[model samples]
Target: MPFIDEPAGTTPMTDTAAHGAASPWWQDRTPQEIAALAAADGVALLPLAAIEQHGEHLPLSTDLDIALGLVDAALPRVRAGVPVCVLPPLAVGLSLEHSAFAGTLSLRPETALAVMVELGERVAAAGFRRLVLFNSHGGNKALVDLAALKLRVECRMLVVRANYFRFAPPPDALPADELRHGLHGGALETAMMLHLAPAKVRSGRVGNFDSLGRHLAAAGRLLGPEGEAGFAWMAQDLNPCGATGDARLATPALGDRLVQHFARQLARLVEEAHAFDLARLDGGALDRAD
Candidate 1:
């Protein structure tokens, strides 16, 4: 659901009970074990997120923590039949948009691209055929997408570049207005953080920071910082608090629902990734689908 389009009719499967303790972390596995997983056509999940400002109410590691949490949640659900391993997440990403605020760090665009290319090379060298470039920070979307293409071309690895939220269906409780602001420090993100790491979430500081489009739409110029009309932006351009969206609408209960939703969707993706291949998708498949 998060990438281009989620394949329909994916069976929901999770067998960690039988396959538990198999060590899906690349760091936790020995070279021999890794080789075995690779031989089994394992997916190498590479999570990329940013350490940046998520308003004053949220911690700087909000994006990183949530992305990692999603990986943790999805791993258990991956069926025993599918081999999957995680590369430790890249903590810093392209976050110049949020650099106006303190505690926001970013990798230069070229550095980000180079690092991804190098990591993809290493993953291919490790004998893995599939790589998932899972990105959480919206700021990293462009570069990460480019990196996925690069990995496919250079490393010859089957790659999936996706935003974690793309897996989740829109929440029913969050109003459309609130959802519009969810791109940055809005309700969905705040809700998920509250569910994942509540202690780090500061209360009494939430509010509805208006979307930048609300100010610019009157100009009939669709040059906001998200979706088809999006471009580079400073977070302050949306709100001085350095986070857009309505955090006041976030709740831990909503966060729990969002987390479970994303995890379930991700499990299906890992399964699909295990079976997806470039070779099998030749004229026979493409001609019919296209």
Candidate 2:
């Protein structure tokens, strides 16, 4: 799938008519229209984001903006056979690590999980068989994973959880060392904001923080180098400003490339979801090992 790069400021909400009647945004269509689409095996995309702080350079709505931007970018390229529609985004997520920061809003893990599961159930009840939980915040991973499982079991529907950044191609311009630790409000994120919402990025205040030691230590404790130890830590513990990489290296061009790459990858996933057969696993018998 190819991504069509629109000029800066051409947002999804503003340009719905360009997609014609096959638009993927559910909010743009009436309930009766959605019902007709659902009868044809349509899938729903629910963008999950966080209203959290992103250092001094990025806006508090950074995650929400990126989540919507990525979904909007991918929707036009979705396979014609799969009628994927995007639901209004769930913009508040699990962001306890950023709770100390001003303007940061967070939901407890259980609260987030319950909200997602309820949304999934409601979508399923409305006759949609598939629900994609498209997440953009790292803090929401645990909740999304758990909610996906519970939704599938309780709602008896296909539920998928996708983290947007996981589909992003690595920055070839940066060193491998920098790539290993730049996970938050860093060059990658800043560049993305520069391309998608430059007005919200404080380019003059862009800076860098080498947090490799803190990240590795946290990873070793939580995930374990050899899978042996575990612990908990907050963003404040790693960096006072809550940023993790060299934002100074970010550029609008790089942001554009990253967004296009992520959109292509996401489109492919949406295509695959359309063809998956849930009935194949419905009546299979378990074989006992001899």
What lDDT score belongs to each candidate, Candidate 1 first? 0.81, 0.79
Q: How well is each residue in 1-290 modelled by candidate 2, as lDDT tens digits?
A: 11245566565332335555655678887676677668888888999999999998999999999888888889878876787888889999999988888999988888888899898888897789888889999889889889989987887777888998666475475665555566679888888899999999998889987674446666554552112453354776667888788888899998888888888888888877777676643654435221
For model 1, the run of ten residues with the poorest summed lDDT: 281-290
How many clashing pairs does model 1 include? 1
Candidate 2: worst 10 consecutive residues by lDDT?
Answer: 222-231
Give the TM-score of each candidate: 0.87, 0.85
Top candidate on lDDT is 1
Residue 265 CA error for candidate 1 (Å)? 1.3
lDDT, residue 185, candidate 2 = 90
